[model samples]
Target: MPDAKQMVECPVAAMLELIGGKWKPVILYFLGSGTRRFGEIAVRIPTISRKVLTQQLKELEHDKLIMRKQYKEIPPRVEYSLTDLGESLSPVLAEMSIWGKKNVLEKR
Candidate 1:
């Protein structure tokens, strides 16, 4: 009920802006189990190139969906985990999993 100059966004579109992509949801689903190192994620999603994965992770981090932590040591260590915002997507991810299993996997 605002002025015509006010901009409105579709809820789904807004959500997609934060998490839409070929890999964001997959990344989120994997991280749902727990924290993961870069190599571990790379291994799980074998098809994604390291460059693309790194870009996706950066975008997710910028959106506040994931946290990237760097440990100080002779050999630098990094781990990625979900932020509270990211955890909120668990229900959505669960539903997607169920849908995929029933509609995608079962039919195949």
Candidate 2:
């Protein structure tokens, strides 16, 4: 791990810097389902531009939160899956999902 100073001044701040983006959590959520290809993820997340999606994936890979696999094939094959570190986030995300369903959905 990087030094505390190198990390965004504080642990929490650094954490947010890593996962607190417009699309990262959502990407993590879908990846929680299982491995998926770029196009598959793109189809599921329709609103994100391809450029943004690529950028987010690269960042996640750099953070060691996700793994990208490339395979040789007729065309080309790539898949993304959450790493163990990323899987550790599952419980938190699940709780948040429950909360959203309860507080946000119940009001509607």
lDDT of 1 by residue, 1-108 (tens): 644444346666678878999999999999999999999999999999999999999999999999999999868999999999999998999999999999999999
Residues 1-108 of candidate 2 have per-residue lDDT tens digits of: 879576758877877788998899899989999999999999999999999999999999999999999999979999999999999988878887899899999999
lDDT of 1 at 44: 100
Q: What's the CA error at residue 7 for candidate 1, in Å?
A: 11
Clashing pairs in 2: none
User: When superposed on Cα atoms, how far off is each prediction in RMSD?
Assistant: 3.4, 4.4
Angstrom error at residue 46, model 1: 0.3
* RMSD of model 2 against the true structure: 4.4
- The estimated TM-scores of all candidates read 0.89, 0.85
Residue 23 CA error for candidate 2 (Å)? Answer: 0.4
